[model samples]
Target: MRASLLLLAAVVTLWGAHWPIMKVGLAHVGPLWFNALRFLTGGLSLFLVVALLGRLRVPPRRDWPLLLSVGLGQMMLFGVLVMYALRHVPAGRSAVLAYTTTLWVTPLSVLILGETVSRRKVVGTVLGLAGIAVLFNPLTLDWSDRAVVVGNLILLVAALVWALCILHIRAYRGLSSTLELAPWQMLLAAVPVTGAALWIEGPHPGDGTLTFFLVAAYAGPLATGFCFWAVNQLTARLPAATFSNAMLAVPMSGILFSAAALGDLPSGPVLLGMAIILAGMATVVAAERR
Candidate 1:
């Protein structure tokens, strides 16, 4: 349990820190192009590792549907939305909004899996909505500014879709060799990312700077490849509620990292929203624990 907690902590920290690094990468690469290269590098590296370990094999036909769901919904769509949102959203706010996947998961679970929604989850959902309202500050929002509104909506949708994918994974009862299969999922998601990069956003704008290469290496190999493995491993070992609650640390870490690495301090409004969201999530966690 101690080792599991430590590993989970390490994984979240790595994931959180990657947000700023991604911001840096985007300055040099287009969203789709960056993700395509990142996924390809990460996926190919994992494939090599699995092959070297002699664990690589052809997945059964039965696995294809679930694999595609995860690859497309979780990786491809989620990654693309996040990358695009980061173009306009502040890193700290983006992290907080993205991690609302916790709130999304409960409703998705109830709807898709016929699970009962406790009163606490309902309260959590309401509070989560309130936080979003605060974050948006509707009274002052300019309807003409499409970027902020679109970015926030995209992040919310990304979080919801990712929640659905998590529930999908939980429903699959026979997922053996998740580590071995993960590379294939990454590669599957890479197809659309690569295609979109080629068709919609042709040619890299980067000047081949050392910073670009550094960020790409971190985002692709350490953050994507290693973190994916860690998430799967931890998910298999931990309780769902416990895992969700523990991952709250991720957005906190992201906020701090953004402040230090990217100088993205949370404003008064953002801080308020974050506090409310955390309280709501804590309520949900406490209810689950009970």
Candidate 2:
């Protein structure tokens, strides 16, 4: 159990950094291509690892639908849309908004999975959102323009899709192991991401430099491939609250990634907002623990 928790914790940190890492890659590659390469390469890498481990088990025919659904919902829906949102907003703020999925996941579990929501979860949700709102306020959102409002709204939808995916994963019964499920889902999601990249970015994504290739490699093999493996295994063992709370690391991870790679430091509102968000997530997590 401790090992499982650590695996998920590692995933939380790696995935948290993903937003900033992908943002860096997007400087050269189209958002579509960036997602496409990450998943395609990531999925391939997972397949290779599972094959080497001899732990790969194909999902049963009955489970294929569920896995595919999860693939689209979690990977394609969350990945593609978040990329779109990132193009319009700052990566740090985008990281905060994307996690609204945690809030959405709480209600979803109740409605879809028939899970009971404790008062703690409810309060945690509110506090988390409050912190998110504080972070968003610095943007001084202008709804009059289509881009700003539309951008924020798009990110909200991305969060919803991801939240729904989390619920669906819990409901789906066919998964045999995280290793098998992680790769297959990536392969499934790769379909849409590649299709979108082709449609928007055209056949050629331009010749990437060494830096571009390096970032893409990290995103694919390390971040997407290994991270998914870790998440599947850990989430399978833990409660959603435990898994989601681990994600409190994401905002901090993104901030650090930005500071290190982008040569940027977080502003006062961002740091303040991140602190509040962590506190709120802690409240919810503590509530769940008790």
Candidate 3:
């Protein structure tokens, strides 16, 4: 339990940091190209790691459904949609909106997974969502702006797509361990993303600066590859709703990371929102312990 908790913390931290790092990467590349490169780099890095560990093998046939589900649904579609949205939305706001996955996951878990969520978990989810509302503060947005409205809507769709993938991950009854299959899943995602980049954005070469490569290294290997693997590991260990709710911390940490990296400092409302999110996460953890 302690180990799982620790791993969850690490995953949240990496994913939180990824938002700002991703924004930096976008400066050097088009959204689609950047998305493609991120998956390609992540897939190759994980493949290398699996090979070095002598654990590399073709995924079993039974695992293909799950591979396709997560690769296409979670990694590819989610990444593409969010990247496009980020063109118009701020990273911190995008992080908060994208994690609306908690809202979709909670009810879906009960409906599809047939899991009984405890009262505490329900309360925790509500608290976490309330915190998200605080952070988002719809009044601040220029709703009249078409690009921003569309971008925000796309983010919600991305969240729903991610929620569906989470349910599928919970339902998977496959042979290969998640780590062994991760590289292949990422490979599957990379193909379509790269194709889309070519079709939509043309064959334009992106920035080749040393800084771009540095950012790509972090975004691909550590954030996308390792973080996705860690998340799947935790998903298998915890209830879907519990795990999803706990992820509310991602945006809180993203806000802080953005402040440090992008100079988008958190205001009083942001701090309050972070506190509420922490409380909500703590509530979920307490429920899980019981």
Candidate 4:
């Protein structure tokens, strides 16, 4: 249990830190191309590791529905929308908005998966959403600006897409382990993303900077590949609402990491929102421990 908690911590930290790194990468590459490269690199790395372990195999036909749902909806569509939105959104704000998946996940899990959520978890989710609302202060955004409005809306849609995928994962009873199927899922996402990048953006070899490569290494192998596996592993063990609420920590940490890496300092409301979010996550953790 201790080890699982540690792994979860590591997953959250790596995922949080990746937000700022992605901001850096977007400076040197187009959004779609960067997303395509990320999925390709992540897929290749996972494939190599699984092959070395002699665990790689073609996904059986039974898993195709899940593969397409997660690959296309969660990974491909979510990645594309977030990347495009990130171009206009601040990394910290973007992180906060993107993680609203928890809000959508709780109700969906109960309705679709027939999972019963504890009242504590429900309250925690509400608190976390309240924090998100605080951080999302409409007063701060220039409502007249189309790019800002559209970008924020896109993030919300991405969150909803991700929430649906999480429910599918919880409901899945499949022949392959999550880790075993991860490479194929990534590959499935990569193919169309790469094609879209080529068709729409028309590739240019990135600025050839060391920073770009470093971003690729972190976002691909560690964030996308390893973190995805870690998340699924935990997801299988925890209740859906509990798991989703616990993930509220991701935005809080993302904000801190963004401040550190990108110097995107948080204002008073952001700090308050982070505190509220932390309290909400703590509430969920306490409920789980009981």
Residue 246, model 1, lDDT: 57
Per-residue lDDT over 1-290 for candidate 2, one digit per residue giving the tens place of the 0 to 100 score = 66775775677678777777778777878888888898999999888888899988777887776687668887778788888888877777788777777777666677777777677767666666677777778457776778767778888898887776666677667736667778888999898778878987899763669878888888898888898667656555666765565565676677777777777687787778777777777876687668
Stretches > 4 Å off in candidate 3: none
Better by lDDT, candidate 4 or 3? 3
- What is candidate 3's lDDT per residue for 3-57, written digit by digit as tens? 9989988998999999998888888888888878878888999999999999999
- Using all chains and alpha carbons, the TM-scores for the candidates as numbered come to 0.85, 0.90, 0.97, 0.97
Which regions of candidate 4 fall more than 4 Å away from where they truly are?
A: none
Q: Among all windows of ten consecutive residues in candidate 3, which has the lowest summed lDDT?
A: 204-213
lDDT of 1 by residue, 6-78 (tens): 8987987999898888888888889998889888989988999999999997778888877787788878898
Candidate 2: count of backbone clashes, pairs at least 3 residues apart or interchain: 0
What lDDT does candidate 4 reach at residue 122?
80
Task: Give me the overall lDDT of model 4.
Answer: 0.87
lDDT of each: 0.78, 0.75, 0.89, 0.87
Q: Order the candidate numbers by lDDT, best to worst.
A: 3, 4, 1, 2
Clashing residue pairs, candidate 2? none
Cα displacement (angstroms), candidate 1, residue 193, comes to 1.2
